[model samples]
Target: MSTAYGLTAVSLVVAATVLIGMFGLRISRTTSDFYVASRTVSPLRNASAIGGEYLSAASFLGIAGLILAYGADMLWLPVGWTGGYLVLLVLVSAPLRRSGAYTLPDFAEARLESMTVRRVTSVLAVLIGWLYLMPQLQSAGLVLRTAAGTPVWVGTVLVAVVVTINVLSGGMRSITMVQAFQYWLKLTALAVPVLFLLIAWRQDAAPGLGGDAPPTFPERTTVSIGTDVTVRVPAPVTVEVRGRVDGAGRAGPLTLTAGEHTVARDTVVTFPAGAAVPHVADLPVRTDAEWLRPLAGREYPMYATYSLILATFLGTMGLPHVLVRFYTNPDGRAARRTTVLVLGLLGAFYLLPALYGALGRIYAPELLMTGRTDAVVLTLPGRLIGGTLGDLLGALVTAGAVAAFLSTSSGLAVSVAGVIAQDLMHGGVRSFRVATLLALLVPLGLALSVRALAVADVVGLAFALAASTFCPLLVLGIWWRRLTVAGALAGLIVGGGLAGTAVAWTIIGGPPGGLAGALLAQPAAWTVPAAFAVMIGVSLITPRSVPAGVARTMVRLHTPETLAVDRGTWHPKGA
Candidate 1:
């Protein structure tokens, strides 16, 4: 694809988002508008906005790439992600909306009647938002580097600057429309190019996926290693080399053994047609048959699969960015309706990425060798379809990729800013603007400083962190009237402590092989249950610490907003 097209596509998305936000700024003139769009969004628009922000890089780019490399087992990711909304609709949406809380901290304090619980909740909410934001920035960097030849930091900084401007302009009110618009743009951008791609595949005699064999390069391909990486080669193959390999410089054909080999940064290795692809050290290598089988290629597959499923299924209600969007609905009923519509919207958008992943195996297997499978979606448009037409489609895909990053980052920024401004600054538009800047800055630095992890892997860990903390608090606090202040606090500390520990350990030092690796990589199955058990056990032992207003809080949470009652809407303490 032309560099001009990539730059133009990115510029258009930025311009469109800003223009839409400016339109929202015209009508947003009060504190309520800044916080929750004055609680008047229709269900369709609300659901669209939710889909816009929710379908981060994980949904748009990562899923397809994971499927390309890991195959059938990876399908569970989308299943768990979409099914999470079902969990939210059934257990959380109506009650959370009826609570009339502007943020998680507000809900925690009102339900438990303790500023202590509120403060803990505020800290956890901010942490979750930042965890989620880092991946958006990282994915943006990866996309821009692919689309244009710019350094990764350029895309990372660009997204942060744009998100900060939009949130500071009109807060949630402005971003709602901005998110809603991006969702359709993303959908169109992805959905349209796929049709032509499928047509091209059919015209090429429908190449087989190398039945029961490891992925192979379809044609001669040259792969440039971006960083030092060890790849596991399944078989020996003669390849032309032009850079450092195994601490020696080479410029001619060499046969690599069928085992681990190290390729240094900036090395260029050329593979001939029919060469077995060598994958990164960490990724699972599978034959087509094994790839089609469940739990066949990965380590401790059963434990890893179940743990991931548990995190995504139970974690949706815990995500601060996702939960805060409910407050934009007009009433509890609207919240429920919006969630129902979100289920459908998310279901529709998720089906497109799998196609990209599946076709990638046949058309773009070189990505597997380079360990940049995430670029499969962008590469497919140019590889299968060529010339000016292909570049145009590629540009459209680039635009959609940018939308994925910006839409999701904007939501996270708004949620984090809302918490900071409400809980710490005592609530005001100016405070919110300052908070927005802070929210974007922390994640921007993290994105720039930390080495990039797989986009989906980082997001899954964020869900685990959320599952361990807010999942227990929200579920127990809303339904179980006996939840006490002390219990909530203990659970927050224990749950957040364990899940956070697992995430940090997994990121910093690679886990040991066997069960220990799987456990650290996906801890929700154990950590989530441990969190709930601690919250319940502690609450039972400390029954005396239950809030005196528990009964009234229950009524407010469970009651329909249509009912005639004082429905004490929650705000930050002393606000």
Candidate 2:
């Protein structure tokens, strides 16, 4: 792909975002406007904006990458992601909107009537938001490197700066329009490339995917190893090497044995057509049939699948994008309706990424060797449909990739910055600007420092963290009047501690194998249930600690504004 086209595409996306944000700036004169767009967004528009905000790097690039590496079971990434929205629509949308809060911390304080609960919620939301933002930045870096050969840090810093500017410019109001537009662009970018890609695939006689043989290079291919990687080949293959391999600095034809071998950074190897693809040391080795089969080539597949389900199905409720929908909607009804519409929008958008993933297996098997499977989406268009058309499609996809991260990152920056400004600092635009910088910078640094985990896996971990920490709090605080301040705090601590530790373990290198590793790698199946149990048990044991006026609060949460009650008469005291 041409660097000019990629850079130009990215430039246009940034310019459009800035211009749209400036339009929003004109009307964002009040705190409410900046935070929630004064709750005037219509269902359709709000749904589109949420689509932009919700479909992050995970949806655009990471899902396809994981699908390529993990096979059919990885379809759960999209299934779980969309099903998670269904969970949000069914369980969270209306009440969360009816609560009339800008952030999760705000809702916690109002519903539980406890400063301690509020502060804990704020801290967790910030932590989770920052955790979630790292992958978005990491993905930005990956796409940028693939597109332009720029340093990885360049993409990371670029996304951080763009998101901070958008968030600081008009806050929620500005980002609403910017993100809504991006959602459509992202859809087009992915959708258009697939048409050409499929055409090209068929022209090559449409190779069957059900064969038991391991995927081999469909044609002679030269792959540049961007970094040092230990690859495990399934069969012996001779390759022309241009750099160091296995600690030898030779430049000639070499044969890699059918086992683990190291390729140093900047090494370029040319494989003969039909040579079997090698995989990174960590990736599962599987034949085509095994790779395509559901639950194949997995460790503890049942537990991992169920844990992923719980994380995504329950975890999405705790994400910032969900809150953005409610805060920007006119009422609970609109929020609920917008969720239903988003179900369609998100569903349509998700279908395209899977195609990219499946086709990648046939066309770009080299990615497994480098463990840069996340580059599958951007890598496919150019390889499948070569020459000028491929380059243009690649550039369009590059722009869409930028939109993916920028839109979601903007939402997260706003969500975290809102908490920092409203809860930690003064209540002004200046505070919001400063908070935006701080909220994004921390995650930017993390993305720069850590580069081991797959972007999708890291994102899944974030989901587990959110599911464990906040899902119980929201479910109980909104629906169960018996929930007490002590219980909420206890639940947050237990859930956050357990999940946070699991996340840290996975990131810093956990146990090498067995059930213990699987449990920590995907902790939601246990942690989420434990969190609910602890919160309920503690709430029952400390009934007297329940907030006063619990009945009224419950009524307010469940009742609609259409009822003959004053909406503004009761605000959380001292909040």
Taking all chains together, each candidate's TM-score versus the true structure is 0.97, 0.98
The regions of model 1 sitting more than 4 angstroms off are: 569-575
Instruction: Give the per-residue lDDT of model 2 (tens digit) for 140-171.
Output: 98888999999888999998988877887777
- Candidate 1 on 1-575: residue-level lDDT in tens? 88899899999999989888888888988777887787778889999999999989878898998899888778888889999999988888888988878788988988999989999999999999999999899889889988997888999998999888887776678889988988999899899999999999999888766598888888998888877888988889899999988889999999999999999978999999988889888787788778878887478888889998999999888998898899889788889889999989989998998899889988787777678888888889988899998999999999999999999999999889989988889677888888998899998998999877778888999999998999899999999988999899999999999999999887667667888888998999999999999999999999999999888888898988678886565554323
The prediction achieving the highest lDDT against the true structure is 1
**lDDT at residue 143 of model 2 (Cα atoms):** 87
Looking at model 2, the pairs that clash are none
RMSD of 1: 1.5
Candidate 2 structure lDDT: 0.87
The C-alpha local distance difference test score for the whole of candidate 1 amounts to: 0.88
What are the Cα lDDT values of the candidates? 0.88, 0.87
Residue pairs with backbone overlap in model 1: none
